[model samples]
Target: MKEKTIDYVLRATWMAVSKMYNEEAGKAGSTMATGFALLSIDPEKGTPSTSLGPKMGMEATSLSRILRTMEDKGIIVRKRNPEDGRSVLINLTNFGLEMRNFSKGVVLRFDEAVKENVSEEDLRTFIEVAHTIMELINNKKIYKPETSAK
Candidate 1:
């Protein structure tokens, strides 16, 4: 990978990671998205249905499909929010809790492997760079719509 652009590196790495996660999740009859959603929900307290999408960094349509699948699989159930009758809470079923534990283990194992291979300083720098990239994107620095109006 000589002279790879930062975008290329980012996309390539993420694609690889996504593939790896999907493969691992497949062994348990799941997808990476399902695993991620499972990990996002609180085991005991549950999470707001609306918040699940943002928490998982996905859009409503995408999250809706995953939630539907999870519901069909008996992994999750929607309950009325005790605090807000207008809102719904996404509660994990007993099976969901077990799946969440599996997801946690998978993520921890990935983290452990990375830590074992990458030096502390390198990992810190990686995180720093990632944050900076996210900040730039969030701030619309790369594609300034305001400036483009001219």
Candidate 2:
């Protein structure tokens, strides 16, 4: 039997995880994006609008849409930053905080389940491999073959 490529395994795993999170979020009257945004924002100080997109690995347009939906749902509020006149801050409402806690619990439960099923050594290796893959992409090592022959 042919073995699956690493990328394929990674993508498939991510898709399955995302679908699970989305389903859970849907049951809570939210989306995965909303739950992620809620988790990303600082509960006390709020998060800067510009910083959230990069922090979430999301584009501004997509984050904007999510924020709008959150605001409409009374989950978040946008306030002008006192320290930076040109920037806006995203703050969670009381309901948003509740949802954030729920999101956190969901994440923790999933993590605990994985830990219970997977050995610690295997989990550590998986984390190391994931970090190495991320580092390769971040360092532009994956697509630098054109420069290799020079």
Candidate 3:
């Protein structure tokens, strides 16, 4: 058996989620995108999918479709950007905010449960290493060393 690592362990953990949330909230891909967008958005700018797509490693068309679905589900709303008429600002609906909070609570409880069994220092180190791995994977495309050149 392979030892649990970030990729395998995290995937397996999420794959084990059998709980059913509302269709609007249960979409893992959309939920994750919304979570990250909430983090990256400024209360002032309100966030736009155009800015969110690259950050979330999603395509423009895919993001658009996701946003549309979310809107139809009443999970989110879009408004024209005041500063740029051509752009739209994404805002969470009341239900959307509640869903975000609920998802966050689930994650927090899971973390606390893990902490109950692990040393604080070990948890800190594990998180730091995980963050480093995530940073590398997220920015892999930005590496520009011409290593194959003769």
Candidate 4:
């Protein structure tokens, strides 16, 4: 049988992991995206609305939807940034902070479980390979189309 490509394996693993997080978040009355946003925001200081999307690697539309839901749920609040009049900052509510802690714990537990099962060397190698793949993509080193195709 032909072996699976690295991209296939990476996509499959991420899908599985995302599903797992979504399931856990559902039990906590949240979605994976919401949980991730909560985790990305600072607990003490607020995060700029404009910065959150890029920080989370989320599109503006998707992030806007999630932010709306979070605001409706009273998980977060948007306030005008004192530092920048044009920008808005996203701040977590009391409930949002609690949810953030829950999300953090969930992530930590998953990491701990993986570390328990996988050898340290293997984990390091996996991280290195993942980083390399990210660098390659970020640098546009792969999949360059011919000039005629452009």
Question: What overall lDDT goes with each candidate model?
Answer: 0.95, 0.95, 0.67, 0.95
The C-alpha stretches of model 1 lying farther than 4 A from their native spots are 147-150
For candidate 1, list the clashing residue pairs, or say none.
Answer: none
C-alpha lDDT of residue 32 in model 2: 86
- Model 4 local distance difference test score: 0.95
Candidate 1 at residue 108, lDDT? 95
Q: All predictions: root-mean-square deviation over Cα?
A: 1.6, 2.2, 4.7, 1.6
Which of candidates 1 and 3 is the stronger one according to lDDT?
1
Q: After superposition, how far is residue 124 of candidate 1 from its true place, in Å?
A: 0.5
lDDT of 1 by residue, 1-150 (tens): 689999999999999999999999999999999999999999999999999888888999999999999999999999999999999999999999999999989999999999999999999999999999999999998898764554
TM-score of 4: 0.95
Q: Per-residue alpha-carbon lDDT of model 2 for 1-150, expressed as tens digits?
A: 299999889999999999999999988999888999999999999999999999999999999999999999999999999999999999999999999999998899899999999999999999999999999999988897565555
Arrange candidates by lDDT, highest first: which order?
4, 2, 1, 3
Ranking by TM-score: 4, 1, 2, 3
Give the lowest summed-lDDT range of ten residues in model 3.
17-26
